[model samples]
Target: MIYAILTEAQNKQEKQPDMADTVDSSIAVAGLKAAIRVASHGSFLRAAISMGVSQSQLSRRVAGLESRLGQKLFHRHGRGVALTDFGQRIMPRVQSLIAELEAFDALVSDTRAQLSGDVTVGVIPLVSRHLASSLVRRLQSTHPGIRLRMLEAYSGQVEEWLSSGRVDIGVFNRYGGARPVYADPLMRGQVSVIGTPDHPLFRQKDIPFNVLQAIPIAMPARPNSLTDHILGAAANHGISLNIALEAGTSSLIQEAMLASGLLTLSPAGTYVKAISNNQLTARHLCSPSVQQTTWIATSRQHPLTAASRAVEKFIKEILYTSTQ
Candidate 1:
């Protein structure tokens, strides 16, 4: 019996620490939360109410934090609170840690309930607005407590953020054939030549790059951009693209093409329903066509929380099944 008890103890010691084992510094979280609540809400009473603590208790927490840190976190006004410069400087980090801890708790709860936790996914506006929303919605419905933070940014910006540890997942077109640190094929589609329905070029089955180049076009600019990819592909084929505008948003680019009869290269999905509605005309930009692969990227160095991993799996499964 003693040997059996010893074996059980050994098994317990061998077990890995789960989500609850990782959390914000206990000393920091209490005061940091109080300061954040005070700074956000202004009034001590309100902050106290939100924290479910008395005003005196909240003040003591902040005061104790200031004593420990050797600096005051908030500037007390007659009836409100404001973050000091010191407080402001540390707030971003505090918020990030808090978010991570909250996510960790959700992960623990999910593990207990056999559900999944939250995932913060960063994506370019084009992809996030059109593609990932469905996946996000589907994950939310199926997984219940799974939280999703959808960060909308420019494609280039998204890549930078992914590299910097700001996001757990990213979706973007693979620009310039450069591979991400870790990637899974999300989807692949061809770039199409888009023009207004009434444009003169719309009459042709397909126009050569040279002819298309003669028309003023709107395309994205340099530094590993989707627009840059399209223009480079055209240049490689010995065609000069006359870009009249470099717009940031797809809506703007499509509108420009509609208003000015300018040409733009876009993914097949970009014009799917619009072309069907006769709002625009799209032809596969071939001879050979410019094709791009959309990929879901994650940091191999930063392991996703279990809940995040679960949601990622669900997203990939759904996307894969849909394509198949």
Candidate 2:
């Protein structure tokens, strides 16, 4: 009965196209968006701050929304709130509807207008320095009106940002399996085996993965994408990695490689400058090359802002051009 009624109402809405109805919906739209912001941030205070409103106003808006629906939308705790079962069921639909409306507005906006907005992009820590430099320089030159915030975080945190609607776009190293989110494969992160030139493995053209068990290496500590992959691969290969040094920072790991004859696995960009300066020797990992597919991820929950669209377009072009 509910399904039938909803279908009929949708059909009627599609056919009638009433301007007065749209005007009437403005208040509901405001309430829905206010509810969504709170849900996404998980705290009324944080949501209000993000929305540039007061906590009391945010609470009132959500309370009004709940009153209209005649259902409690949140289970409030001291620290934050979680969506009620009813809210969980409808939030995705509301988010999608809002995204569609936002996209429509963007489509009808001035075609030649300068893109001016804040866009937050999350990137895996390994790619942060390289991508941030290139992206900031290009955006500054072309889309001067756009403000870009680059967040360097682990892949898990980046994924959380996407799901929570915090980031406009993000990059992650695709490993283990494909994620249950929208992603575009930007490039494969080339993994390399590195050692100082004086080391015995320095002359190698290609390094076998299994040899890592025997090599003294400096590796990243926990909460790193590369470290996770290395550990996984080690487990699968039934080999114990000879991790001589475990460092929390990449620079520290690099220092271990430089100070000692410790071989290490690194992304191509990590040691490219050092390799060019005759300080290190590197070879692509062979026998099933150690590599990660890098992806540009976006949330289905929100439409890309004009600034985000421009940034995404530029990044796609840059990634494809580099691959070519």
Candidate 3:
């Protein structure tokens, strides 16, 4: 019965020429809004302040709407304003229009909620520990209905996940090495040599690359590691990199750097908290620092789910805000 009534009303509204004409007038609601608000607030200055617009601009907009309506909507009384009879009559419809807009906004929000679905995110080990945890927490907290699955693995494994349909999105770091097919720069981060505070080179102003390369460093294995890029750079400059430990996991690298006093490079954004906690000392890599571009890419065949999009948006926002 309700559906029939709604359909009849919709058909009737569609047939009415006045309703079609009002469509253009309704489009001007935003401009008419200032007039309605000014009339309600009793002062253009107060309405302007409330709306975050200049008083003159608000007055002009309201006046323009009044001109279009061919009616004096407001009377300028000393120290304040009052709605004219025509303004008073039109206000109920204006209020109705505002309520309808709110309803429309709410409908969109609900539709987005209904469209949201589950997503499995494949994150490289390097960023998973630092960015993924917080990102997951934010997503779960904000959208409790969204189901998220996280696959944490080595960078090469992450690439495989991206090639396969195993994950919707993959986050990896580009260190001037083998480029991923669909990757783009999501954020730029520094990969700096970190060590214990008491390490010999910790207090030094500018440690020569040659002197630094002689020290044993804990680095990630090649094929897709930022450490590999650092090593390649050193080699290009005719410096031999003396790596004491090779690990597939960033956590393992951090543990080894802390326990064995071997320098390991880490993204500054990820490691800043640890640096602040005095767990590690971040020093600038000599001459040319190892800089890396962190990226977010979707699998070629996999379409992104709403949950995945939300998580991606959150990550981009957090990274942008933190970097700023």
Candidate 4:
């Protein structure tokens, strides 16, 4: 009987190391996150800087992840790194998994009586300039527990963030068309020709679209939505634009206008402060007006937490009140 009992104890001891090995060999959440960050940035140094971690530490975490997966995730070169074929194939699934985990965490947090969590919002520069402070103040007064994080970017970047589940909400502009099925229209604003106060265009209440044919205009560079809109409008109206300057941002275009007497076509909201201060003047484009509709959108890929929903509500309220 003593021999039998000793044999059973020995068997249990043998299984302990196996269980320990299983736990140690499993992929860790931290490692997966590190790998994803590195993949997104295409460089370990950049990823580490973005994550507020040391390069060596981030490298080690990704190395461990690669070991567990038994695949080389990145091809290192002098310029940076690129994902291996396997990494490219698996990245989408990994991103989806991480998004699911975040959603689950938000779901668990929502069960508590008080709504509290981080809500990330992406918006175009125009929306950010106009509504960021108001949104922050409203959220602080109403839902103090809900932390608001804002990402100001162009419309295309905001759309990418929304699609990737990187942000809880997105505010962007849709020009000259029906609203996208996924987004809710918040407000509509006229796109106008803007120039310095001394410019000849603002001499009238509104400028005809054909007038732009003779005007030397400053515009955003090609591959931009606004640039595309203006080009398309010019094509439809059978007029040619004399593009005097091509800039990367609205501020640059405005600066060019001030220094060179160049005019730019943009939304009225974009230069509201400048217009009000008499630094710039806007003339509405008429006879086939160009309009931009601002949209509030969310990802269909992820579920919204209660905190996100609360922030969304507050955003809508602020927009509606501001429009009124």
Question: Whose lDDT is greatest here?
Answer: 4
For model 4, the local distance difference test gives 0.79
Q: Ranking under lDDT, best-scoring first?
A: 4, 2, 3, 1
**Relative to the true structure, how large is the alpha-carbon lDDT of every model?**
0.69, 0.75, 0.70, 0.79
How close to the true structure is residue 274 of candidate 3, measured as C-alpha lDDT?
66
Writing each residue's lDDT as its tens digit, candidate 4 over 36-125 gives 888887899988876667999999988887776789889998889999999898878777776666565555555555888899999876
If the candidates were sorted by their TM-score against the true structure, best first, what order would they fall in?
4, 2, 1, 3
Q: Give the CA lDDT, 0 to 100, for residue 172 in model 2.
A: 75
Model 2 over residues 105-208: C-alpha lDDT tens digits? 55545354778989999887566776778888998998798999888765667888888989989887766455433577887766888888888765678888
- Top model number, TM-score: 4
Candidate 4 wrongly placed segments (more than 4 Å): 1-111
Q: Distance from true position, residue 186, model 2, in Å?
A: 0.2
